[model samples]
Target: MKDSAVAPTRVDGYAELRDYAVIGDGRSVALIACDGAVDWLSWPDLDSPTLFAAVLDQARGGRFDLRPKVPYTAARRYLPGTNVLETTFTTASGTVRVTDALTLSDTASLTPGRELVRRIEGLAGSVPMGWSVQPRFTYGAHAPHLTRRAGVPVATYGAEAVAICAWHAGQPQCTTDSVTARFRTEVGTRALIALPYAYQEPLVLPTHAECEARLDHTAAAWRQWSDERTYTGPWREAVLRSALALKLLVFAPSGAVAAAATCSLPEELGGERNWDYRFSWIRDSAFTLDAFLKLGCAPEATSYLWWLMHASQLTHPRLHVLYRLSGGTRAPERTLPLSGYRGSSPVRVGNAAAGQLQLDTYGELLQTAWLYTTAGHRLDADVARRLAEIADFICTTWRQLDAGIWEVRSAPEHFTQSKMMCWITLDRALDLAVRQLIPARHADRWHEERQAVADFVETRCFSERMNSYVRSAGSDDVDASLLLGLLHGYRPSDDRRMSGTVSAVEKTLRQGPYVNRYLGPDGLSGSEGAFLACSFWLAEALARCGRTEEAVSLMDQLVALGNDVGLYGEEIDPASGAFLGNLPQGLTHLALISAACAIGEAAR
Candidate 1:
């Protein structure tokens, strides 16, 4: 942690949490500052209006910030399976610890009208403590009217009113309008800051005596969830943490998983590559399902596949690559004028790229459905018809130019990976039809299209000079996306072309454990930090190519990139190893879990 002089105002803004860590229930998440403030969170659910808006606009964004009244240093981590966060602050007077969590309701549905608890305990000598309760509403555009209800600070903005209060207090006032509490505490002195809805049914807030038992319950719950993981491998802890991260993104009600929690956190800080990742992307979740299934988290795979089936039945001309976490079809693109993260403008909300035709999605969809079928689930006739329809659509459209997986905007090309995915769709559809004895009207047509795509990829997509398959036909540039072709079983990993492609990726895209998605600008300006997941896929490909040692070494290097806790962002700067984009990124963690398990199996 770097030392900066504290002002009445927050010293650092947007990127401040980049140094902080994340804690969350599977339904909602919060960011905790190292100084012990619970800064950003979407209450009730991930999609709900935030109670702590300070994370987006620190000056105006409200936060539930808690810290030592005296200057201090701090560090924190999540308690294993649970989303509980324990951050310890060391002051010159003494060391104090604060544990934060939202107690999981025994009921299935969650209401915002529930309690969120923050427990602060004195660990050593006497230390003065401070708590600031600022509740801004509507993304920091409005201030809530504050009142005292049953001795708790309750702020009402609109229909939604938030209660913010200090559990233990002794010291004086800074302003009549603000809720600030400052006090000194001796060893073993404890406080509980409980924030519950003003209108909810009255419930007993946990007492200081009950805090320890509550913490124990949180830890036990997480352990039980983690014990269900069947991966008994060398990197079990890393794999389990990654699985937990993926699970954290799952929207509990519908089983749809968000691609990442945040929207418009840039891949390049000041670049235009920022896109809202809060929506569910079929392509992303397909790989997520594969990762979960590989680690024996079968329920996650099953739930998400059900969500995928519901999403695919929508009547869009081309299926959206991404949907709202609630399966909403319309994601209108818009931008915010607020000062972006590190002056990175315009902070975007809904993803416009959702409407673009990414042909690879069909392959991922078919493959994911095939996994469910292979795992002994029966497919309904309507779903089988829809699968055949997707295959037929790909057979007709695969020859046309479309946005490739990277969502390049200038002009679409005959991307090798996109074409290979078409091969996967056809191959999987035919395999399922034949193996499962389902009648297929388009089997011969799908097979014919599949062969043509393979022939084209073999002949035109390969670069003789590069000695590997290039990004697309008529281009010598290679892509990291093509590395997954072998992993998807489109071709034998030991094939001469597959081996050469792995070597080519190492030469062109490898930057430590980070990998670039592709070489050469595809009508976009500026460069990005190396993508973490593509690099892992490359490692998995290498392991399949008989390079097990190098694969394991790369996995180790990648795992080391996680911040003190087992979490990673979307990308890492090769020179500095700083996390970029969204925190606790789903794609990066899912790939890590999959690659580690795949390499572990190879070692045996």
Candidate 2:
């Protein structure tokens, strides 16, 4: 790393989305920029309002900063097989290493409700270090009440409190909105900082020794989890990293997997294309279950399927596009007044698409149930009956115009991919019925509707001139999501129609490894970068089509697209290589793992 100023450059006080690395303790996540600023963090739960919304509004939003006080260069990476981040800062005077982690609980010690640990070590000459913690609660809507608690600087708001603990750091100067400190480090010197948080409970003041032990134990725990994964594939490292990122998005209390770690981190910069992704989506159910099982995450798979069944029970036969991580059905869309990341205005909180009539979610949910049962997990009588009813519901639902997987805001249309997924939904349910996993009473009706869906897709959804499955009936636009239908067994990979659609996707939607989701209007202003997950789906489609070499080549390019720490955002600006959506996006990582697994299986 080349020498630079003490602080990393920012776009109007905001770090670029690509510059972030995340560390989480399975409940909540924090996005730490390369410059050692924790810019985004949601307390208590992944879907909760953020304590630090700096990524959305740098001013008024709060953050934690820890770095050398003088000019320096920094290089960072996750310690191998761990979510713990080790950032090495090299200054003219000396070198220092900082390890950042959201510590996990240990059986041997009394752990805090939540803890963020930062450990620093000096290896060369003296280097001055500075640190600060600015706490803003409720999406930066409230400035924290700063006070002292048992000699430690504490910030509290309502029922939540966070204690800042420091050792060998300068006296923390309490300000109206933050706590600031500075100190110098000598050779062989060790210093530590810990943030212990409590929600509706007493704050835990941890000793330095306890923090150190927790940090060490957290790293070990993550390493052990990584070691337990069974993905010894061609892109093992990327696959494992994707798995780790996905695991962080899984809510530990409930098995719901959040779509991304953050909310409203723009799909298009300075545009009205931002939507909150902190909720779990039925759209990703199939991929989530497939990825968890393929990576040997049996426990997560079981928990997630159970969560899915229980959460969807609220709507029963009619599934919503997304659900709250806590399994609540009400995600009332709202906006915050804060300036968005780089002036992407109207930073959003909840997703309005939950009420959309997406015909594809049924397919994804049924596909998930089918995957679970096929993987040897049993479904109870009620779940089986519910699955059969969902299949019966899809029998009629597939014929209606609805929002497709893209969840476009435009008028609903007969999206070909949605119809294909509808077919998968019934097809999977029918197979489960045959296997005696689900009630077979509606088997004949499901079969008839499945055939109707197939006929509709083949007749109206396919383009004769374009030689591909169109985005919607009577429209010539090609969608990258069509690849998903093929991967999910809408048809054999070698089927002429499926192969034609794959080639059409490459010719129309793909700009090398970067693939646009579609080239049509969505009733939204501004354009977004390439959808990263679609590209992974393309690679997997190729592998499943028996084009192993092409799949491997494409997979290599997509893997290389990730940032230095092997993390991906929701979208990428293909022209500038800038990450354009939420960082550490779970769907993108899920696609990566699924693609890697498919390519590896095809090669074998």
Candidate 3:
């Protein structure tokens, strides 16, 4: 081993949520901070156990650091039309540029064995840099043993293995704990580091030059893929960035998109609202498909349809609200031992909402099938039958009380949003049947039930005193989800009742341009940041209601709220503008895309 002459630099306790940006290779993602420390990453797959999770527990959670040793100021941005992250650091001594990416193959598939490439180039005078590679498997439950194989440092813990290769003037010193290195680069000098992970397989070390070449190829692939996006409307940059973020969450092998890359990033700091979002949520996927289809990206929509069909096949054609990326039905929620983000204890894995009877899911699934057909993709006979069965199930069960779209932990209530979505299921299914995309077995019954659902919601969910729809049949509280009524076609955007609900939402849920999912208790103790998606929904609703000027103003503000890299988290603190909850959240990105599209259409 090389001499341990240089001591490791200690990073500050934790990075602000907005200070991190994500890069992925379709299979997994990494959260790299502005200071060039990789604080969270999961290899092999998005749902896989985290290998580096210092974002949650700074002291015990592992990380990989690669940054200038001297004090420096940094600025970062994504390469145009790609997920490649580039951060430039300037110090009194010199300047350096670091480019990071989870390399993709030439065919745009995730590179085999899940490789991450980081390249550092000298921009001017010589700059000293420090680096470390540490792996803590299973959320810090297991520590890997480090050794050198073929002159490349490898870390192994049970069935998992990862190899780190570096192309630098100085050699890395491998201890049992980590691999550390220090080096200086002068003008025209360059260094490359690649880390590839494997499960129950031997590590394959690649030359640093080969890894550097792969980075260029990956960036080209991303640019090519992004060029296929069909949205050329207002806020195009924001829309494209959101689309790219959604692409990062997709498990390419299965076409199942994770709701977000990380789990247990608290919705509220020091709160218990944190839950795993790495699995595919039916509602989120349905909305994602809608956004992709609107952008003329049919391939992603088709891939999601296949994933849904396979998942339904495994579940006997019965749909759960969420499912594992591999099509499994079980997702038992459990708390981990590690300290949560910002002292939020009992970090969670898996989601209990999978078992809840979320009535909105049927509408979402049927709507997705309708979108698929509209995109000119023919559904196989089995898939068609499965979709019909799902619609049939919703027809019979729409009257029952269940969890609402927010996935409340309280006793199921007759949420107005659920009823509205049930109405949407019948409406979209009727359209599909009329188009002959599927057999209209219960056309008359569906028409009848659809009207009945509308009447029931109008009667039971509306509040006379408030002159708007309430959260549920009896409750008088307003929910941001009610803004979706216009988007779902539950009522005309100009209708008095629909307009009344908009007014109610603005009055109760709006905190400037942000909106809370709900003000009432959600069977949880602490408060959460304003849900970013709900605010976008408000903007869409406003545009659809012919409030185009107001919508455009809000759109400008919301678009500017994104991080410097044009990414959003699940929520944002209204007062401080700090990101809260999971970074690069899919639902949030989808909503932003939808809002931008709505604004564009309204403008035209």
Which rank order by TM-score, best down to worst?
2, 3, 1
TM-score (C-alpha, index-matched) for candidate 1 = 0.92
Clashing pairs in 1: 54-61, 81-222
lDDT, residue 548, candidate 3: 96
Model 2, poorest ten-residue lDDT window? 1-10
Ranking under lDDT, best-scoring first? Answer: 2, 3, 1
RMSD in order of candidates: 3.4, 1.7, 4.1
Runs with alpha carbons beyond 4 Å of true place in candidate 1:
1-11, 14-18, 107-114, 169-178, 197-216
Put down candidate 2 lDDT per residue, 1-604, tens digits, no spaces. Answer: 1223234578788887888999999899999998999999999888899889899999978899998989987888899999999888889999998999999998686778999999999989999999999999999999999999888999999999999999988889999999999999889999999999999998889999999999999999999999999988788889898999999999999999999999898888899988899999999999999999999999999999999999999888899899999999899888899989999988888989988999999999989988888888899999999999998888877789998899889899998989999999999999998999998987999898889889999999898898899999988899999998888999999899999999999999899899999996899988999999999999999999999999999999999999878999999998899999887888899999999989988999
Give model 2's clash tally.
0
**Residue-by-residue lDDT tens digits, candidate 1, 1-604:** 1233222223455544346567666777777766666666776667665667555566766787778877777767777665677777787889887888765544333333445678788899988888887776655667777776665566776666666545575532334335778777678887777665533344333344344455456567777888887888867877887887787798888888887776666678678776677778878866788877777878888888888878767853356788777877888878765455665567777877787888898899888888777777778887777887888888888998778888887787888998999899899999988976345888999889999999999999998788889998888898999888888888998798888988999999887777899878778777788999898898888888888999989888877777666777888878777667776688888888778877987998
Clashing pairs in 2: none
Which lDDT values do the candidates have, in the order given? Answer: 0.75, 0.91, 0.86
Q: Please provide TM-scores, in order, for all candidate models, with all chains considered together.
A: 0.92, 0.98, 0.96
> Which regions of candidate 2 deviate over 4 angstroms?
1-7
lDDT per residue, candidate 3, 54-108, as tens digits?
9988877899999888988788889999999998888888989899999986543
